[model samples]
Target: MASGQVKSAAFVLLLLNLLLYFIVTVMAVWAVNHAIVRSRKTASVLTIPARIFPIYFPVGNMATGFLVIFSLIAGIVGMATSATGYLNVTDGKIQNLHAAAASSLVTLFLTFLAMGLACKEINIGWIDANLRTLEVLVIFVSATQLFCAGAIHARVSEVATILNIYGSGRV
Candidate 1:
């Protein structure tokens, strides 16, 4: 397969992965909100403990795990595609590779930051709220990163077109 085709496939896979990530995030947020509502509505604090344990524990763990795994996968795929692009050595391809690598690195950093914030057990009054805010920030950053990745992929396709024309001896 041609380098262009490989790049395009990688981009498509990345987009699909991003879509899945988005879905997972939305579901997790909904689950968390639902749990919060239930926690608020229940009458007995003791019974509430039992109620929350059944719902919150599983959902929160799943959500955290999913985000961590998805972020890691995205970073790895982006790096692999970038490496492939670099190997291709075409001018247009290089740009795509650079963009992919940079985006991946940024994503990796962001994910780690999010994990750190979420995992910290220290709670000094407003700390829980602070952690929640950080989580929201991570979500926003991830969405932006997804958009940038899609744009980079589109640019790669355009570059491939130009390169093909140039290779074909067309002025």
Candidate 2:
């Protein structure tokens, strides 16, 4: 019920969220490798939906991986700053918490969007090739969205802090 307790709870949740994010990322990478191996053996592309896209193009894997790493870093930084601010309960820290949380959330959102677009592209390629890439891409996109949702949930407390600061008639 106390603010300290709330902050402690938030910290625990954030750590758990981070753990899940890491797990999902690892799984996605594994899935991509598996799909590539299967495709190389069978020379087939897997199709899912017209909305989904294949990521067979050059540099696509690097781009997706970069987005994932960036999102992960942002999430970690945001959660760390938020936990510190909550634990310290000092003035002016709230703004830092807010900005960090917002930036992290935005990064996560962008990452999710990129994953989705990649999935869409992969799905399109599936129509022509029998590659299992579409399934892997879909799983990766789902994981990204789930991770982003967790980050957004973690940001809620920080966002409230920002709103309260502005509402209190203090700059």
Candidate 3:
């Protein structure tokens, strides 16, 4: 694709990822807080099994804890990736593109981890509506993030090819 087209695609993907990641972050935060408060409120009446769990989630299965934690980390990293991506795309600098690609790759990996946990949680069942929402969002984000990372990586390759062809940005 043309450089302009690549940049535009990257920009749009970054913006979309930013918005989705923000929502994920908000929902994950709420889920964590809700779980904590509920767990604390029921601490006095907890059963032996509940006590054994590191973090008790009232709704989902054991995978809930890992899923939520990974989701929160992915959300945060995804947001930061979006910011760096935006800057790199706008600046059109090869150096910044490298940074953006690295961050996006990290975010992609995190999203994949969260997605895997989410799938496990789903398979185990007993998840609530909010958790289902989070799962869906994480799944969706993982797909979009893959695309975003690919776009950045494509741009990086394009720049590299251009630099190799001409030995510099200037002809």
Which candidate has the highest lDDT of all? Answer: 3
lDDT of 3 by residue, 73-92 (tens): 99998998898789887887
Better structure of 1 and 2 per lDDT: 1
Q: Please tell me which predicted candidate would have the highest TM-score against the true structure.
A: 3
Runs in model 3 with CA error above 4 Å?
none
TM-score of 2: 0.43
The stretch of ten residues in a row with the least summed lDDT in candidate 3 is 162-171
> Which residue pairs in candidate 3 collide?
none
Instruction: Kindly list the per-residue Cα lDDT of model 1 for residues 1-171, writing each as its tens digit.
Output: 465665555555455545544543454455456545665455244454555454332223334433434444444544454444334323444454556646555654555554454444222122334335435545554554555455555555655576687763221
Every model's TM-score = 0.38, 0.43, 0.94
Model 3's TM-score against the true structure:
0.94
Better of 2 and 3 by TM-score: 3
